[model samples]
Every structure is written in C-alpha cells, then in structure tokens.
Target: MDGTSSPGLARSLFLLLVVLLSSSVAFIEPCDLLYDQAVQAFYKGDYGGVVRSMEGALHSYAQVRRSKVGCRLRCEDQHPFDDDDAAAAAVAELRFFDVVLRRSACMNGCIEDKLGTQSMHRVSEDVVQDFHRRIPYNYLQLAYQKLKQPDKAAAAAHTYFQANPEHVEMGQNLEQYKDLQGVQEDHFVDREARPHQHSFSAGVRLYDQGDYEGAIVLFEEALEEYYKADVECRALCQGPQRFEGHNHLLYRYSLHELISVFRCTSLGFLENLVKRERCLSRKRWGCPSQTASEASGMDMFGRPFHLHGRLCREAGGFVVKAAWYLRRHKQELELLLIGSATMGVEFSEGQYWSSTGGREDSNRIPSGTDGWMEYVPISEKKNVSVMSPPQLREGGPLVYDSVRLVQNSIALNGTQRVLLDAVISEEECSDLKHLAHTVTMAGDGYRGKMSPHTPNERFEGATVLKTLQYGYEGRVPLRSARLFYDVSERARRIIESYFLLNSTLHFSYTHLVCRTAITGQQDHRNDLSHPIHADNCLLDPEANECWKEPPAYTYRDYSALLYLNGDFEGGEFIFTEMDAKTVTASVKPKCGRMVGFSSGGENPHGVKAVTGGQRCAVALWFTLNPLFRELERLQADEVIQALDSQAQSQWDHGLHINPKDEL
Candidate 1:
C-alpha cells in the first residue's frame, strides 16, 4: 500500500512543477522585468541601484533586439493589425513572412504566445523595447546631471541625441551639456550608438572639414558597420520601414492633396495653349478621363469648406503638356481643350462642373455660368499645337550640337524625356551650390531649419524667392541667383523643343535643394531622401493610380533636376512606376547632368537618401501656361534684369545670357 501511494505522489509532484514553470513562462518581457526593478529603485530613492537596473534593462533590450522575437514584434508594430481577427491571421502567417520578409516571425510569435492571456496591455512591447534601447541614456543623462557628474551627464545626453537627432528637447539638452564646465565634444561618446552611426558621423564631420582621406577611412568602417547593422536591424524589425502586413486589404489610401488650401483636378480637359491640365481623380471618383459633364456632382474628397473660393484659384494653377494659359472673361468663363467641342459648362452645386449643349464660342463659357470657371483672353490665344516629338537634327528652336541629351530608359519610354549633359557648365553648378548653401543656411529654406523629409535628415532648399531675397541683401552673389534661372531655362528649352510643344514652357518653380544625413537617425529612417512621388500628381501605389489633386504641383508640365556636387553616398535619382517601386531608371548625380521628364504619375521618381557628405541639386519645374508662371522666378529675373539688361530673358527663350557669369 505504501509503495503504490509513493508512485502516485511522485507523479503529482511532477505535475505541480509543470504548472509553476508554465506560469513563469508567461512573464517573458525581460526588459519589463529589469525596468520594474529600476522603477522600484527609483521609488526607493536608490539612484545607484536605479542606474544598475537600467543598465540591465538596456542589455535585455539589446539581447531581445538580437533575437527574432523582437524583430517580428517591431515589423508588426509599424502597421498594427486593425482588428483582432486580423492579428490572429497575421500570427498564423508568421512562417510565410519568415520567408518573405527574411525574418523568423514564427519563433517570435511562439515566444510571445506564451504571454497570450497574461500580456501587458498598458504599453506595446516593441515600443518599450525601443525606449529601453534609446531612452535609458536619456534617463541616465538626467540621473548623472542630478549626480553632479557633467562629463557622464553629457555622454548620456549625447548618446540619446545620437539615437534621436530630431528630438527638440534632447538636442537642447545636449547643447546645455556641451556648455558644462569641462565637457568637450569627446565626452559626447556612446558605446551603444550603433557602431555605424559613430563611424559615419565622424566621417561626415571629417568630410565637412576637408579631411577626405580620414573621412574615407571612417566611411569604410561605417560601411562594414552598415552590413552588421543591416543584419541586426532585420532582427530588431525597427525603423519606419514598410513591410508586408495582413492588412493589405486596408490599403485604401487616397491622397486628395494640393499645394495649399484647396485642390482641383481637370478630367480629360486640356485646351490648346489655353486650358489647364486635367488629371483623373483617384479611387472612388470614377473614370480618370471623364469629361467635365460626366464628372459633374462628383465628390472632392478632401476639399475643405473654406476652399469654396480657392477651388478654381488653385485649379487655374495647373498647366498641361500643351502649355496653355487660362484667362477670365467678363462674368462668363470658358475653358477650351483641343479635344473637346463648344460645350456649355454649368456649375450647379459648387462641387463639380459639367459641359453640355452647344456654344458658338469654343474659347468662352456660355453666359451666366455658375461656380468657378477659367477662360482665356482673345489676345493671349494662339494657334499653338502639340504636333509631335522634335527631331533635333531637323533644326528645332533650340540646338545642342555640343551638348548630349541621352534618352534614358526612364518612364514614358525615354525617347522625349532625357538625361541632359553639358547644358550647364561645371562652374555654374558650383556657384548654384554655393548659393544654395548660403541662402538655405540663412534660414530661408522651405521648412526653415527642418528638412522636408523624414526625421534625422537636414533639408536645405532655397527657392528662387529666397535666392533673390539673399542676392538683394548681398548675402548671395547676383550671378548665382541668375544662374538658377539660366540653368533651369536651359532645361526648359530642352523640354519644349524635345517634347515638340509648339508653345514655349514657363518656369513654374525653381529650387536649389540639399540633403544631409544626421547621425543616429537611421533607427527611424525610411531610407529615402525624397519619397517616390510625381511632380504633378500623388501616386497611389495600391490602386496603381496617380491622384492629381491639391498639394501636388499639378501645374508642373515637366521636371528637371540638375545635379551639382556628387561626393556623397546614396542620393541617386530613381524613376519608378506608379507603384513607387520597380525601378525603371536610375540617374547618378554629377555636375551639369540634368534629368528631364514629364511631371506626372507616369514619371514617378524620388531621390535616395544622402548617406554621407553634402548632396546639392537644382530642382526645376516647368509649366506650359504663362498664367501659372513662377512668381518668384519672375521676381529674380527682375533683380537680374535691373543689373544686366541681357538677363531680361524668359526661361524658355534662346540663350543671350551666360549661366556661369558671377556678380
């Protein structure tokens, strides 16, 4: 009887041990475990203990980052499953993504599934993990500050800053730490700031100081670190990277954006040198090429109520391929396109416009039309026609015997659109770059101190407006400001002549743009200097449609990016399909090299991130319509015209001015 009872008791004891282990497995958040101890030490006012626990917490985060569990959690955290069932579906498909995404999500889910019912709902594990890696230095920064150790405090602040360059407060804190009695730049070192970031930052600093060899040595080290980091980053699933999600069905993205205030797109309405460009509305808006009559009463998805007056104001800005200009008639406005007949455009509800019935005057709208209507005047109207592509050898208006316009296999088959070489000289490129750096550093860029890119980037773009503003102030050379026009004008001539538009092109916009990488920002980087986009329309990747609406510079007929300095890593100009991936063409930037293309969804393009050194370029946007002329360019032309009478030139005119001439 005793031997039988002993066997049963042993089995019960084994079962009891299994229950305890299972419960222990439910608490798998090691970062949380270490963090709880730090929190307890903080509450107890044991500052040393808090530091020690946080050190362990940071190690836990690093270990988790090296593990598949953290990588999978981060990949999914970016675009969280919008529903519980979707989350379940995602969890079930981990194996598929493990192969597709190249990260083993299956093991991560397996490790995380043990915490299913016992999971903490207060904060996401991935978010906490990120904080665990970066924010401990921030806490340590404050702790060391409280401990009266300025050197260690500065080091902590610097570490946090390296991890997050865009954090306004930490940048300020780092500035303060640097001011501390004996804290030098050397004190701003971190052991955990991604080995690549340290090497890259040092390289960039050296490069900026003209120490190219030293910078190169460091850059090579950075590259080696980059490969290691790439593997580690994959394991962490960190950054604002786009990844495959189970919510592919929720990819209903419609960018009803215009430049500012309001957005209006023309649908199949392009007049001969007198009509605004038409864009097919994107998703749920029906046919892209529907006539105004067919598109009547359609919803302008993002048009605000304040845009009632600004709709046509913004619509009038768009210039199609034909180089048409719009004008206003007395009370009645007419928008005539080459493909359409004399039809009456009636605006009923102030939402959509439709054309129907007959009107004798093809160029004028019918009497008493409502809402916003654009018309062309009789004097400005011309017999301009978009005949065909220009045969350059046949002697077009512009000749380039010395220059080479290489037709790249970019979008639109690349015959008309080209990569222009030798249009602008090397000296001209240098001056414009100098002007860009000078004017942009004067706090006159589009975003003023902040770049118009993802976090951890520094963007400096000086528009024709700012360049002229600085030139007038004598901060920039007059010749540099004029060169911006001269170079862009050369590009315009190429577009007008090559595209064979009988009418000349006009400057819609001109910008001298620069992008630089800030160290430690890679953790949040999307890896694009400029996200893939169309100059005149918003690209809808999921629907494969180009939404031409507000915020997009739809008035732009052609885009020309003239490359300046090229001693940088990355920053390649890539032409993509409407999908924004699937590279069709890539143009490496160099002095005097210009990429000319149609500014539509058909020519979606973007600049890759400038990983090292400074990248400078002149972004030139052209429009056919004189009405939508770049006002800033006109202002610059005025300033140049005052100084040099020969500068009284249109961006589309034949050359009478020297681009390399400096004031």
Candidate 2:
C-alpha cells in the first residue's frame, strides 16, 4: 500500500513542479521580453521591427520604475536603490537601456543600406533624438557623412572627442574631422562665389519661360562669377596650406548652360528661317523683279580691259548683259558686247530672247569682248504640311487620341510614340492622392529637390512629392505597393496591347513623382519642368558625352506616366522630335490620364512648369527580361503574406491600425 501511494504522490509532485516553472517563465519582466524580441528582429534583418521593439522596451523600463517608486519617488529615483538587491536591479536596468540605445544606433544604418541614404531622414523623430542623446556621437557622424552633411558630421565628431579626450582613436578621428571641416568651409565659400546662386537661379527661370536672350545675359553673369571663383581657387591650391580638392562644378555647369543656350538659340533661328522661306515661296510670283549693274577695269593676262554687266531675272531665270573694252592708242574701245541674254531657259513661245541667236557658241564673241553668263533657277519641291489630328471632344468618362502619323510617315517613331487618355477612374485618382498625403504625414515631408547643381538645370526647382523605390527583394509599404501594382498592371496591359508585344514581358521597379507649384515671391526656378531628355541616357548633365550601353538582359524599353490629379497649371507633357524644334505631342495632365511612350532617343520628352496647384504622377518602367518575372512573383507573395499578418494582428488586438503606422 505504501509503494502504490508513493508512486501516485511522485507523479502529482512532478506535475506541480512543471506548472510552477512555466508560470515563472511567463511572468518574466516585460522589458526583458521586449529586448529579446528586438534581438530576434535584428537578426532577421527587420531593422524597423527592432526599433519598435526597443521603443517598447524603453516604455516597459519606465513603467517598472514608476511602479517601484509608487509614483512619488522622483528624487530617490536618481539613486533608485534602498538595498543591495535594489541597487543591482537598478544597474541591470541601466545596462538594458544602454543596450537598447546601441541597437537603435544601427537602425538608421540598416535602413540606409536597404533603402538609400536619402531614406534615413524618414526615421522617427523620437528615435533620432533618443539616439543623439544616449548613443556615442560616432553613429550620428557616420549618418551625417552618408547624408553629405559635412558640417553636421564635423560637429558630431567634435562633440565625441571632447567627451573622450583620452580615447585611443580620438586623436586620429579629430584630425580627420578638422580637415573635413576646412574642406567644407572652402567649398561653401566657392559655392557662394561662383554661379552666384541667385544669378544662376534667375537664369534658370528665364530659360524655362523661353526668354532665351534674358537667360543668356544672366547665364553670362553667372559664368563670370565662376571664372573669378576658379581663379581664386587656383591661387589657394598653390599655397603652402594643405591642398583640398578643387571644385570645378560651378564652372562646368556654367559652360554647359551657355552651350545649351547657344544651341537653343541657333535652333530657334533655323526654325524661324524655315518658316520665313515657306511664307516667301507662297508669294514668290507676285513679287516685283529688279535689275542691277556693276563695272570694273583691270589688267588681265598682260592686257588692260574694261568690263560692264547688268543682272536681272526673267521668267524664273537670271539674265546678264556685258561689255568689254580694249585700249587702242590709249583710248578705251569696246571689244565684246552681249544683249537680251536669257539664261538656262528653254525657248518657249514669247519667253525667247529677241536679239540673241539660239545656241551661240562662246567663240562667236569678239576678241576682248565681255563674256555674258546666264543662270537657270532650279525648281524646288514644295513641302505639304501634314495636318494634325482633331482634338478630342471634352466631357466624357474616357477620352483618347491616337498619335497621328506626320507627313504620311510613322509619327515620332520610338520614344515619342504616345497614346494619351483618361484611362483610370476618378476614384482611383482620389485614393492615390490620399495615400500620398498619408505617406507625407508619416515622415518629414518629401525629400526636396536634390543636387540642384546637377547639369540638368531644370531639376533645380523640381520637388519630388512622395517617392517610393524598391528592388524586387526589398519590401515596400503596403499602400505604396498596392498603388504601384494597380497602376503598373494597367499600364503594362495597355502597352502590350498597343505595341503587340508578347505578354511575357514584365515591368521592373517604378518611380513615383509628385510636383507642386512655386509659391510666394520666389522665382520659378524651383518649378518642375524636366528638360527634353531620353529616359535611358546618362543622368548627369555634366557627363553629356557618356553613353550607357544598352542592358544585356533587360532594357527600359517603355515608360508610362499615370496622372493622379490634373487640377494643376503649367505642367504639360511635351514630346519633341530629333530636331528639338518640332513638338510631336503636348499632353495636358488630367485625373486618371495615362501617357506612355518608348524611352529611347526616338522619343525625347519633357515636362512644362507646374505653375499653380499641385501635380502627382506614377512613372512605371517596363523590361523584357524573363529573369525578373520570378523575382516579381516572389515579391508579390511576400507582400501578400505581410498584408495577411498585419490584418491578423489588427483583428486579434481589436484595433483599427493603419498599415503605414508601422512605418
């Protein structure tokens, strides 16, 4: 009986021990749980998740302190220790906080690597401020360096060295930072001097408005400033001081602008000349005919002779009468004379010369007589202008105009081939605009115009509204991905149908751009007007001579634009022919409108300025490579899984959470 009872008692005790251990594990401190989650997230390459977990950990630590002090030990909280156990707990909490801070420092770096350096600014303000306060300044220094903010990086480095004067690497880092600061200051001075930012801005404004002459004047002034700055830079480089790299960007920029202006001016002149010639030819027969004469006397072949000629046009042919003289006993005597000369004209009815015999050879002229010549005007072929297609009638759910062939040939073959229409519904347009607004609110507004000093001067005032770019393996915000998929799918279908391409061709990464109007009294330099350019060329304006080889596996063969909102002024999509003077098409943005074309030299295009209100559009680029299909498929699946998980979480928590709130 004792043996049986002991076996049952042993089983009961084992079960009780297991239950107690489970409870203890479940009741672990919230901070510890959060920190563990953060570590797991970091290992999974989920930097955003890591940041969220760390934030929760910090909050949990705060709650623990509050509960320990009964919410009334503000002064004692500084020491936060009533006994050895309490002191140890307090020390452990501080160590945890330090670990959290260190992990958060890597957040921006990971984000930059996955997205781009420009995306670092999208990090939360709270996270950034906390990092600045708690982490070493080196992280901030590295971030600012990546951002190209040298001054800020230098300041951070300076603060770091001051804090750790005896640090092993402090001397080396401090020296490097000082040198960087000096270089930055030099560049700042040079930037201020050359192109005189204000003057350059004014020049760009004039150029955009078609005021070529005014633009030329301002550009020249900017050019002068560049020259002076360059001279000073050279002198500085020759001294005994440490040699910082010279910046010739402004000089190069000014030269490029001058060249572009000159080219545009010459093209404008040629276009005007062609138009004037066309007009003159229309009234050629009605114009009055005029006669002119000239005389000269000179020694030729050791003989003195006098010559006289009269020139006139008759029946679309030039006629000349001439007389020549020879000296006889110091007296000038006429030796050769010609009259009623009609040049290169067939003898037809009343148009024949009366005095001149038909087919007279040159030998028939008297010795020393002046020689008469005639010129027959060659008939020029008349150019018949190709009529433009009739404009589409307004007020319709959908309207479109197929580009008409010009001069009975394929119209703007290549990149210029475009179909314009309101393709999507107003609902989609409204939804996209709302999504863009939400994205803007979640981050520091849009990244303003970048590297305005690029060769493409038109980019100076161009502000990107909300841009989202991702590789096939990278994750994109759910809303942005949805918008991208919908617009690109529709655009791909349309392009395939129009071009009769195989449906197997798929699209690659896309770029979404939004532009707003220039406000206040600033010159329209910042207005978004993409200069005429091929989509597949070297992006740097300074590297105009660089030619990118066509991709082997994939090519940006086709480009499409979907306009989300059209209630804007001045922004028109303009396509120019190879000559740059002829506009193949000028499309106005309309809500739900889509315009697509080839993306090579065959279709150079640009945007006009956005004068009022705002403009938003999604640009989708397509490729023909088959390898990208698998990548795109995997990405789509990942997006689906992410969406499902998010939905499940929201439902489980019984909370109406915005997907972007996670971002």
- Cα lDDT tens digits, model 1, 601-661, are 7688888887777888888888887768865565555455545643445533655557766
Q: How close is candidate 2 to the true structure, as a TM-score?
A: 0.33
User: Please, what are the lDDT tens digits per residue for candidate 2 over residues 1-663?
Assistant: 111122223223433433343322222245545655665666676655665675565555444322322211211222333344445877877766664454444433422332244232233333433333323344444545555666655555444433232222333544565556343532211111123334544555666676755654554454334333322232222212111111222332233233222222112212222222222322333323221112123343212132222111221111111011111201311111111122211111121111221112221211111111111111110111114422222111122243221211144343335555556677767866765554432112222323232222222111121222222223334455465555656667766566555445476545455665546523535533666666654333343321222211125666788788878777898877655446777778887667776555556678877666767777776766643443333344344445568679889887766899989
Error of 2 at 556 (Å): 1.3
Candidate 2 Cα outliers beyond 4 Å, as residue runs: 1-416, 440-484, 521-528, 538-546, 550-554, 579-581, 626-637, 641-663
Error of 1 at 663 (Å): 33
In the predicted model 2, the residue pairs found to clash are 336-369, 415-603, 416-603, 461-526
* Error of model 1, residue 46, in angstroms: 38
Global fold similarity of model 1 (TM-score):
0.40
Best by TM-score: 1
